[model samples]
Target: MEAHTDIQTTQKGFRCTLCDVNLPNEPTVDAHVKGRKHQNLFRLRETRKRQVQNSVFVSGIKPNTLSTQLIEYFEQFGPVQDVIMDKEKGSYAIVEFEEQASTAAALHRTEHVMNGLKLRIKPRESKEFKVVLKKKQDGKNSQVNLDALSQELCRAASVNEQMLRVVESFQLNENERNGRELLVKLLQEVFMEFLPDCEIVPFGSTVNTFGVHSCDMDLFLDLEKTRTFQARSKTASEPTGEGQSEDGRSEDSILSDIDLTTATPAEVLELVAAVLRKCVPGVHKVQALPTARLPVVKFSHRNLNLHGDISIKNRLALRNTRFLQLCSELDSRLRPLVFTVRFWAKQKQLAGNPFGGGPLLNNYALTLMVMFFLQNRDPPVLPSVDQLKNMACEEEECVIEGWDCTFPSQPIAVPPSKNTEDLCTLLAAFFSFYATFDFSASVLRDKSFQRECADAEKYCRSLQYQRKSSKGKSWGLVRLFAPSCPTGAGAGGRQGQGEGKERHLELSLPFRLAALPDAVQRRLGTAGERFREQWFAMVRLAVETVFQEVLGCSPAQEEEFEGQMDTSTSSDAVAMDTAKEPEEVGGHDQTEGVAAPSGSSGGVVSPQAGQKRPFASAETSPVSPQEKRQKLCAAEDEEEDEGAEPAPSASWCWLQRHPVWAGRRKVRRDLLKARGVTGGGSAEASQPDGGGVEMELQVTRHITAKEPDPHDLVAFKVGAQVVGGSENTRAVLRFTPLCDQKGHFQDFFHFLEIFLPKTTEAFLGK
Candidate 1:
């Protein structure tokens, strides 16, 4: 009797269906229904119901299995809201989750073994699912199981394994391809009503077989067929009285009025954009890029969440896309290797969609490089385009936009490659090949010109430095003696030590530092000691940052010592003379504005600005050479007393682990001289002929005092060329090393090099 009463209570007791709240009496139920809490719960239930509308459908449920058991088992993934079963038609169930993510996750588990039966799991069917997007289509799913794939990739031991995992995670599955095809067909049907005979072709990554998840779909609208149809219409007597198209749309359409032969690409794109916005059901965000290399109308499908573009002029791109697809099909290894290299470059911030269209390499360019490397591999992993072209039959020969586009249509037409390198080995080799690559020698416009000039000078210097005695100084020292170290016998050593070290090798020697001339030491006085200490510190930092960190070489160690290099200046007269002060360049007059800002690139005046010789006094001789030299010396002494310091031309903080800036000064001097102008003269002195001649001579002598590191903290003043010729100013670069020797601070330096100059220019309103 108690059991019967419990059953009756469960059947008829008052309960809030929306919140699943039980009420003991009718009055309590009425109050709960009218409460704000119940209203909020009702809204939440509606949202959950909408989310599970895209639930996972399960089939092959056993007769003994109940809905409660199904819910309990699946709820481990997420909260299961409902489990609707129908055993009469078939043992099937729709398992709904409170979240859409759960549905997406469940779709990845294609087969689930439950109660000795293998059940097929898929997305619940909807009327629009086939026409739009299906979580699972034809047994393969649309979304990747990222958690599982990420775990697998993390566990991968080699680059080869990681690359393969990346490919598996990112590649388009057969079902996705089929869905894209269906979408293309649906679009074709809609376009046919307007274009009558136009053809829509898929291109780019979508069909190139290197597609990643969510990559944009590229489509080409071929209007050539429309021209052929129009020609037929003109030749016919009545043209079929403007009948309806196959899809039953009007034959007289806005697109029909367009003459493809004469219509501008922009006009056609705008027309497409208008059609997509007004006529297409799911298309949104319709935009036209008329000024693109190939004008296109871009749009996104609401239901599918897929972005696409339609182009009127991209036939060459289509051919290239086909070629890439063929190359990918020829070998299974190509796709994985390309994907891995692209991923690495992106991780390194070396490539991306650059701002203002800077020189950042795109994915296509990287892919080509990979393909080229493979083709040039030992035993040849893939055949070259020329080889593929030669394999084509007469009918298979093709040309587009006056360039050969011929290649074997099928993979079986070409013989299989004999190269057997594994993915891991290939990936490792790819990095090793690029890390040591001298891109300046092989690519970049400026590098090519620099190389040509360097080679000529190098050959001449090598002949000059040919050894007089084998037991004498090594070629390393011989090259150092040369002005630019342009030589061959010492080329190997210079390459090993780097150009910067080649410049500093003699000066940095302990013997050379100890044997500093007395006259030079006296001239520098107290500043000389401070200068030496700073120079040593700069060299240490360079070695730590460049060699130890970048090259993975053992760091050269130095012993600490207190030497006689220290010289303290206590005399007020000497302090007053040597103290640094801001000085103007042309004339030490009050008329000059703030001194020109310095940078790695150029000064206040650009290289393109038409400039006359700054030393105009050289052309007119008022005094003899000796008397003029005396006057110039006297003027320099007076300026020294006035506490004038040389205005720095430019300053830079370089972060390359190599010595790229080693030979830059030489290039700058040569470049200035080539334009028939001295590189370092002030507007008032150091003229082309003989003006400010004394200052120029002193500068030459000082620059040759000892080879110097540009990074050393030294103050620049109005003087002759100190380091590089043709500069009237001295460089006072200060090098302060941070304690983090292993490159914790190197990133900040790199970031500065990239952005600091641009920011400086922006601040100056350049």
Candidate 2:
């Protein structure tokens, strides 16, 4: 009877219980629930429920109440999630429980007595959360929900799928894109009003389409048209009797006091900043970074919650941005790979600058490295920048800051890649390629000498007559990263350490010479020896070049130091320092002035004018820890000795966090103790401390004292293995750990596999 009286289940309207609102139809009800007000109320209801579900807000907590005591008391209710104390407001705290039932049970009592004081209990309030978009300072990171991303990646089907998922998660959403676009349009309109003919163009990640959700917007203030307009206006207003004002200025001109041509870059930037601060609505945090590599007016848009920079003379950044965009558009694989590598680098802590003001391999550098790899692959996956330039139309030809930046603007202009490899295989290959690459050299294969006309007439010409073509052919002539040729265990290796000499000979000896008939050996005699030496010299040069240059053991030495590039700055429009060459970390090659070849007795053994001079003390005898520290400190303190030959740069072997190298002293001690040697200074010294291994220890100890940088001491020397060559030469590995401690070494070594090459490259300022 009650059901019959009340039953109106088939009502025309639907209702929202949380908002306490009714609607006309189901669709209207759906719309109402999804509407802003309804959503807010729904959020509030959920937040309130969540706060009360598993948490009890205590109104009277003692200031001295320990988290341990809270846990002890709260355990009576149920397992505690966390206890958040509101210390500043009052002696209060919110004790969160693992179960809602426990929270409700605890609340049923409604009151409690502790420390002889009564306390009132309620539900904790949920704090509001907001997305904070911030500029990346040198050592700080903006807040990101990376844990959610990690979980998403964990659920991905494959590494390929994971990479794509990561990109999809981070890529700018439609709302963000629309926000940036609107801001760009508004800024452009304002700028055009001030300069009349100026065009505000977005570049960098913002326009590159590879932009992540919170990447900074880079705008190029194209004042070329404005400048042209200004020149014409000046010509037309040249004290004309009809249209000139009494001040001899154009009547329509607002820029009478500002001479666009004569104004310094800093002045222009300041002017831009002034205009933005005064006239542009929603634009704030206006600043002029005149001393920045690319002088720009940086600002934030209140409406968009976005940061941006406006530059007047950064054409290079524009070109670079276009190039990146083209690459992204051409290959679906490029962006995903870049995103994966970048995230991996960030995760492993290999990519952040340590606030000491040295270069880290930024996203730009990483992108270039990937491009180089693709261009170099067999049946190449991507065309060279030079090839792109060649395909560019006449109208597309561009020169910025004396560097040709010509490349096809459209992805369609680029020919499809011959490489049909899947994303998973390519990703695996990328890691594998870098793992074995020689970082001490350029990644580009050396331009091979080609005989344009291989005829009888050209046969008599000297090797010097075979000219190297004007730099780039397949790629852009300018190498993105050009490290020094690989020295390998050659010029970079330490020598004269007893058996080291024999190892060197073993490595350098020609295999052919060992098998030559005795009669032939006798007949050739000294000439044969010279021939063998020459062959070894050639082999060393060839091998080292292949390892260092082609393999990328070291990071490429950049042709010029561009200074610290602002992430917000456009890559194409950045004013390149074309004249200022990078000061090489390894300095000028010592072998440059050597007259003899590498394998000659005179050349290999003796010091040359520019070559690294072997230290008699270091080469002939072992260096004590004290002496080593003194030398390192002195070297670190002293300015670059411009006149003196550069010393051989110390090589580092990276290991993951393992007790292996750290346990060296213990291992040595144990070995000593096992030999029944105890309580003597000699016992410590007698622990199989081979020369190469001892040298590595000395290097680590000294460098550690000198730099005191955590990163510089990442790897330690545990032992050495003689990489035997021949009777004359050998290379030594001064830091080989005993074994992988579980998978710790493998996991750590994977990072090193990426890190060492990058470290070498970064040291060279590639």
Candidate 3:
């Protein structure tokens, strides 16, 4: 048989790492894993590798040679630094140098022929690159004063309303983006460094219908070839990238024909930001987080700041994203519903910012849950995205990408009924559905919800409402569209752990949004209700924060997860979507910790989290590169000459990674009232009131393995049982690892911290 890939002999039974042959009682199998035959082979491979450092693969070397022989051979260019030798693999190791330039020189100078073996030398990809960029850019960027700008905005907020409006208009309106076309061209030139000939398309409020002044530029960086979007148009003389007609007529094309396959997504986004910063004077702050809301950057130009996300999505992901975006667009009811709820929640100080959350809720998450709730209703509140696509006005697809291309179609019948009463009814419906809905069974089989909804519809039909909409559609207070998965989309394909197969994951009926286990759930439920009870504003904050914390608010990550959620944190993190791990690219650790709150501090944009203000810091690496070690005598003299400052401990940085977040109802009185006295408004409200529901959540350990498993990201499963329900109502969910560390009580606390306050306010309506 061929050599076993993963055969290892541990203290327990015979363990075969690769070929799964459990020879529990066979001593031969055990010995086969750890014997002189394997040991000698391992040493021989290791010895050969040690002959030349930084080699990708080194094997079959004489074991008798010492380190001095390897050092002498490489010393020809200059003095060498530390050498890493893999004793067992005998395959490869890394070598560091005092100077990066010197290291670069060495990589070029030494390719092969070191210590009787060809060697491989190249710069190792590591976090060290961050340090070099950080140090060099730090000084130059200091000139841009972010604090002054923040102070100016804050002062403006206090007095000058017009200034804020002007600033807001620049951010929210499409007209502000007029002078930005030239800027966009510059950006395209830079992005082409990676995508070569791909196009950058801007959508959302930036294009107009209902835009605000402060809205971030929502752009879709399309890296696909030009042939993809080319569709026939109505006009004959218009220039198009579309195919030539058989009748010798020019076909319509959405954009110019282009080729785009030479570069990766990362390279594309980086180049665009780099080029924009160089060409645009007011544009700066280029952050490239591929795994963020969208793999792009957020920067400002000419007093206007915008964040752009790149979508190099496959046809399926693209279709899904576009479908969802269209659903929000088709119904003026959809975007406004979500945006209003989000904004209200923020204003009330119940949740964090829509874009940034401390332990904040994501607007998308709440919208999704709402969508699921409405879909499960009888007759379904709205159509799925695919169904909507088929029903959209032809003008929805009307493209006008040429210079000065703008929509000229007649406005359709969309209403303007944004009021608090409608919001309250929708929320009431939301709670009722969760309290009564069952999601474990087949969705199509759940007829009770639809039946009740039908009854409600009949009741509404008998009653009188002013005007009618498309077909006088039987309206549910809260409308939703749960698009059925396409047979072609292959929803039944190999399922991931966190990913749902049939429909996007749905909550079972027993899951009371307000119900927490009496021992644990009651306290949480009460706190959440209490927060809701207070200034209704507080409840809004909780909604935004929790949605993001429990679900997800990240646009880019959401798009990624819409495809697959890999929950594995092992040596293979960069490998594939087989597993997902806790996110910790920056010093910020995703270890389950206290979720941040919703307020000015909490509601701020996330990419700007940990950062105090915008335009404050330059884009650079986080750490500094190591310096060359001096000779022993010189090092001793230097040390003797000056005492050094102690290095910051890991614990300090660890604590700094997570910030405290809370529901407004939890500690409003402490924040707004002096001397810890309860104010007015509502007693159930944690803010105005000095008292809170004194209860503790008892979290049980549900870890399956006693020993550590490197591949698993889930620490445990949390189950909540309602105390007073007629029938025992229970809720259970699997928790993914947000960090590698084991002892993470913070996530639980973050949940309860914001949840309890809001739950309390909800029940009491304080």
For all candidates, what are the clash counts? 9, 46, 81
Q: Can you give the TM-score per candidate against the true fold?
A: 0.43, 0.44, 0.32
Who is ahead in TM-score, 1 or 2? Answer: 2
Q: Which structure among the candidates has the greatest TM-score?
A: 2
RMSD of 2: 25.5
- Per-residue lDDT tens digits for candidate 1, residues 1-766, read 1121111234557655455556676555666665677667666656655755658888888755767778877876689977766624547888889888888777776667766678888777654211122233321321135334444554555445666877877688777788788878877877776776888899998899988766779999988887666556545654445554333334445655777678887888887776676556677888999855457898988766778999987899998998898888899999998886665444333344433233345778778878987987898999998999999888889898789999988888989999999885665455445544444223221121223224323432452223332343333112222222222212222332222211111111111222235543443345432343222222223222232222222221111112211213211001111223334442333111222222111111212224321211322322222311111111221223253322222111222222222232343344345656653454423232112323323333334333443222111111111121122212222222212222323233232232222222222121
RMSD of each: 24.1, 25.5, 28.3
Each prediction's Cα lDDT score?
0.50, 0.50, 0.36
| 1-766 per-residue lDDT for model 3 (tens digits) | 2345456556675665433345564655655556555555556545444433333222333444434455566565456564544433335554544444545466676455755666665556433111111223342342243223333333332212312322342234445567456556766765554333457766545553334445566556665443332232223365444555334444322122222234455665565554454333456565666544346666665554555444444333333344455445544444444543343233222334444544444444546666665555454554554444354566654332232212212223322223323433453455456435554333222222333333333333332211223354322221211111221111112122332321111122222334333443444344432221111222223323232222222111111223232334232112121233433311222221122221112121223224223211212112211221100000011121132211100100011122122233333333334434533444433332212422111100112121133232212212111111223322211223223332333344345433433344433332
**What tens-digit string does per-residue lDDT give for candidate 2 at 1-766?**
1222112223755555444455565555555655677677657656656755688888777766766677787788888987766534447778889889988888888568766778788766655533233335533232235545655654554456766887888789999988888887887887776776688888988877668766778999888877776777667644556645334544334465588889998888878986786557777888999855357888888778777888898888888887888888888888887776565444333343433222235566667777777777887888888899899999999998789999898888888998998665565466556655544234221111011011111321322112222432211101101111212111112121222111111111113333445654454354422333323222333222222332222211122212322313321111211112222322232211111221222112223344332212223222223312111101122233455432221221222222223323444455445667753556344433221233324433433343333321122221111121233222211222222213233233223333333222222221
TM-score of 3: 0.32
Candidate 3 deviant stretches above 4 angstroms: 1-171, 174-186, 189-196, 203-213, 226-264, 290-294, 311-330, 347-350, 353-358, 369-381, 389-728, 731-748, 751-766
By TM-score, the candidates rank as: 2, 1, 3
Error of 1 at 476 (Å): 40
lDDT for 203 (candidate 2): 90
